[model samples]
Target: MSVPQPDSDEVVEQCENCAVKTPHNVSIKLITESNKEENTAFSREPYRITECSQCGAKTRQRMNDA
Candidate 1:
């Protein structure tokens, strides 16, 4: 079976593997999680998935609301 690939945009960002700002594929994903307490509503958070084009290293970072 073939795996589905996520849609990403090319952007300039810091890459850990390259140790410098480089071109990377960035995708935004919304994560949903349930609260530990009972009868609580689930929380939705947005995160950015970054993949370095040069070294193929991947990283995830939470997106904060300003």
Candidate 2:
């Protein structure tokens, strides 16, 4: 099953481990490294989020760039 979106800014996705919908603060940050050969401007950072409060399920999300 797909995760549910309750509103903007925060995601109310369902946690399979907890068997409930948990609120998560979502954000996207660019990945960078020192002394690296890869490009700094176009690196993809995983859309990250906190664990579910009820069952402590680790969660991650994907974001789209505008």
Candidate 3:
């Protein structure tokens, strides 16, 4: 059986205010990137911010593979 992969339609995270692992509003965008030839462009990854659907607390996260 194949493991179910996470799709763009899903939002998974823990809310500090609610103190539960619930679905949240995840916003992703490219913050900064490296232009050096040797450095991997993936190193300067995008920001995966999560917002609580309950209390609406925003949290910033560095997503390396996002």
Please identify model 2 stretches exceeding 4 Å from their true place.
Answer: 1-13, 23-36
Residue 11 of model 3: what lDDT?
Answer: 79
Count of clashing residue pairs in every prediction: 0, 0, 0
lDDT of 1: 0.73
Per-residue lDDT of 1-66 in model 3, one digit per residue for the tens?
A: 222333566476767877776667788977656666676655567788887655678888777753
Which candidate comes out best when scored by lDDT? 1
Sorted on TM-score, highest at the top, how do the candidates line up?
1, 3, 2
Give the distance in Å from residue 27's predicted Cα in candidate 3 to where it truly belongs. 2.2
What lDDT does each candidate get?
A: 0.73, 0.58, 0.68
2 versus 3: better lDDT goes to:
3
Candidate 1 stretches with Cα past 4 Å from truth are 1-8, 35-41
TM-score of every model versus the real structure: 0.63, 0.46, 0.53
Estimate, for each residue in 7-50, the C-alpha lDDT of model 2 and write its tens digit.
55666766777677776555665544334567755565556655
Q: Is candidate 1 or candidate 2 better by lDDT?
A: 1
